[model samples]
Target: MYKSLLVTGVCAGLLAGPAFAQPYGYDDGNDRPEYARVIRTQPVYQSVRVDEPRQECWDEPVSYADPRYQNNVTAGGLIGAIAGGVIGNQFGGGAGRVAATALGAVVGANVGAGAAAANTPYVAHEGYEQRCRVVPNSHVEDRVIGYDVTYRYGGRSYTTRLPYDPGDHIAVDVDVQPRAY
Candidate 1:
């Protein structure tokens, strides 16, 4: 009877001790909170540029001449002949005068032609000309890079940034036990 009583007491004590000891449950409580269901999500964006404006310019040469100076050689010769004829008339008499006149005319004509040809004047006109070409312009705009998530758990609302959208419910682990600090 004594032995049986001792064994019974030992068994009872073991059971009661375990029951009174802190219930073997979860939370060390210092652990971080887990993710809960997402309530609302909004996309985040950033702006960027894809193209730019640039200007390019260059020069071109153009040539032209005075219309009146077109036939310099011919005009000069004619004027020279007329002048020579008058001068010869004043210098010699009869046949001698005629010969002199003829020689003078030939010499004058040759001189005039040479002078006019050598002294032909040309003008160089400089003008400014401008032209413009527009390149099709474009730019890149900010696009959604990620999502801003609002989640609810433990009867509280929380916010976070995520690379992708989490829909509806997010998984969470609960702690039945909390540690005393």
Candidate 2:
């Protein structure tokens, strides 16, 4: 009877061994680390626009002319007529001298008026003014944002995006579990 009991106990222990090895809802922290072969790699890029501020400057010409002396000739005409009448009195005889003096005064007044108009000096001012403006220079550039990696593990292919290049091989975590069905 004792031998039969021992045999039954051994059979029960054997049946329960698999159940204790893998509990239904427990983790033993037994994830295995393995390597996966890299199938292909491609670089991912992003387009970005950059704006830089710059100052643009140029010189503009400015000029001004005085308007006070533009059209006044009264003083010069009166002075010229008086001088012409004296010179004409010295040039001809009695009656002829009087006629010559009148003619000379008229001619001199006209000449003096024209001379005053032509000789008036105009006051001019010349200078430059500096003008400036701010302009934005913009340009577009392509930047590498990340890398797309394709790898093969356990006869299956997978693709993932990573921040850096994972050379020829990548480390993978493997965990074994029983199916729920």
Candidate 3:
């Protein structure tokens, strides 16, 4: 009887050993999976600035007058009048001298006026001046490209970087195991 009992115990141990070695929730059991919902999806980004420099050029005109012209007209008139008067005074005698003096003065005055008008100085000149100013041109550019995902699983919320956007829901795996003490 002791041999039969020992043989039965050994056979039972061998049969159960394979059963214990197999994973749980297999063979006769089924696994239930919990799925999470994608509550929201938002895009994340960083601001970047870019600058492009451009140069613009143009020409402007400037003008100026000669200073010598202003004084020359008056000086020429005075010199001409003095010369005319001296020449006229050298001719005539007596009563004729008096008449000649009057005529000379008149002639001198006329010559002076004519010379002044003829010598009147006026000149027009054209010149060009270059001017330039820098105008800063700027604009904003969007350099942000990313995504933030919010998911709900087992009555709890979780956030992570989702490479692809989960349409409506996400699948979450939950496993149960017996603890050894």
Each model's C-alpha lDDT?
Answer: 0.76, 0.82, 0.69
Candidate 2 structure quality by residue, lDDT tens digits, 1-181: 9999999999999999987786332336756457889999999999999888899999999876665554456656876787777777777899999998988888777777778877887677898999999999899999999999999987889999988999999987666667998
RMSD of each: 14.2, 14.6, 16.2
- Clashing residue pairs for model 3: none
lDDT of 3 by residue, 33-101 (tens): 556789998877666666666666678876666556545655655665666667766878787776776
Ranking by lDDT: 2, 1, 3
lDDT of 1: 0.76
Root-mean-square deviation of candidate 2: 14.6
Which pairs, if any, clash in model 2?
Answer: none
In model 1, where do residues sit more than 4 Å from their true spots?
1-35, 52-136, 172-180
Q: In terms of lDDT, which candidate is strongest? A: 2
Q: List the residue pairs that clash in candidate 1.
A: 37-170, 46-142
Model 3, global lDDT? 0.69
Per-candidate TM-scores read 0.33, 0.43, 0.31
Kindly report the root-mean-square deviation of model 3 from the true structure over all alpha carbons: 16.2
- Model 2 per-residue lDDT at 163: 88
